[model samples]
Target: MEKFDNVVLNSRAKYGQFYTDPNVGRLLVSRIETAAPNSVIDLGAGLGSLSMAASKKWKSASIVSVELDNLSYFSSLKGNHFHIYADALDYDLPNKIKNEYGEFDVALCNPPYTRPLWKPEYEKILEEAGLSETRGVPKDGRAELLFLAQNLRLTKNGGELGVIVPSGIITGERSLDIRKKLLDNYCVGSVVDLPRGVFSNTEAKAHILFLKKSSPYKKNIKLYEVKKEGGV
Candidate 1:
C-alpha cells in the first residue's frame, strides 16, 4: 500500500481517490445490517480498504472490487475476490455485472467526488438506470451522486449499501434534490458524521451513509458522530 501512497496523493483531486481508513471501513461495514451476505461489491474500490474490511467480517462471501486505477494493488489481493479494471460509471456496467455476478447482496463504495460538467450522456445513463427522477443531480455533475446511483442500481432489491460521501451531499443546498430522492426512494438506515481530517490530505467533511435498496422509505433514520480515535 505504501508503494501507491504517492500515486493516490497526486491523483486525489483528479480521481477523488481518498483511501478509507481501516477503522472507518470496519465502522461502515458494522452499520450494514445484513447477516451473512452471499456477495459483496465495492465500486471505485481504491486500494480495496472497504472491501478488505467487508472480507474480514464476512469470511464466506465472495468479494468483488471494481477500480479504474491502481490495478497492481488489486492484483495482489488474495482470497475469494474478483478485481475488475473498469470505470464504475460505464453505462453498460450494470448489465455486464448482472450477467456475470448477478445483483450483489451488499454494496460498498467511497466514490470519486470530482464535479465534472453534466452532459446528455450522463442524463441518459441515469435515465436508463431508472434514476431519471432522482433529485439533486447538479447541472455541473457530481461524481459522488452518479456513483451512488450506480451502486443502488447494482445492488439487489433488498441489498444493503454502505458508502462514504462528502457532507455537502447530506446538507448542502445544491444536494437537496438528491437527499430528497434518497428519503423518498430508499430505506436510509443511518448517517454517521465522521471526524474532520479523516482523509490524509483533505479536511473536507464526510459521512458514512447506509441505505437499504427498498421502497416506501423507512423514517427516523439513525444519526451518529464519531471521534477520530474511536468508533461510533
Candidate 2:
C-alpha cells in the first residue's frame, strides 16, 4: 500500500486521489446496517481498500471496484473482485453498471476531495436524482457530492451506502440543500466524525455517511465521534 501511495503522491493533486486507510475502511464497512448484502461496489476505489474491507465482512458477497488511475486499477485487479478501469464520474457509468451487475446491494466510496470545474453532465445527474433544484448544486463541481449521488443511483431501493466525505458536506451552509435532499429522499442512518490525519496525505476533516436507499422516514440518525483510528 505504501508503494502504491508513493507512486501516486506526485499526481495526487492532479487526480485528487487520496487512498483511504484500511482500518478506516473497515470502520466504514462495519457501520453499514445491512444484514446480508449480496453485491457490493466501490466507486473511486483506490487500491481497493474499501472494497477489500467489504470482502472481509461479507465473504459471500460479489465485489465490483472502479478506479481511474492506471496503476491503481491494475493493482486492484489482484483482488478476486470485478474491476472497472474508468473515470467514476463518467456520465454513462451508471447505465453500464446496471447492464453489467444490476443495482448493487451496497455501495462504498472514499471519493476525491477536489473542486473540479463544473461540467454540463453533472446537471443531468442532479436532475435525475431530483437534486438539481437544490441550492447545494455548486457552479464549480463538488466531487464528493457527485460521488454520493452516483452511489445512490447505483444502489437498490432497499440497499445501503457507506461513504467517506469531507466534513463540509455535513455542516457547511452551502451544503444545507444537499443535507435536505438526503433527508427528504433517503434514509440517513448515521454520521461518524473522524479526527484529522486519518488519511495518510491530507488533514481534511472527514465523516463516514451511512444511508439506506429508501424514502425519508421519521427516525433518529445516530452520530459518532472517533478521536483516533480504530476507535469505531
TM-scores, each model vs. reference: 0.88, 0.89
Q: For model 2, what is the alpha-carbon lDDT of residue 200? A: 72
Q: Which segments of candidate 2 are over 4 A away from where they belong?
A: 1-12, 73-80
The candidate maximizing lDDT is 2
Candidate 1 per-residue lDDT over residues 17-112, each given as its tens digit: 677877788888888899999999999888778888888889899899998886437544567788888988887788888877889999999887
- What lDDT is reached at residue 141 by model 1? 66
Whole-model lDDT per candidate: 0.79, 0.80
What total of clashing residue pairs does each candidate reach? 4, 0
Q: Which regions of candidate 1 fall more than 4 Å away from where they truly are?
A: 1-13, 117-119, 128-136
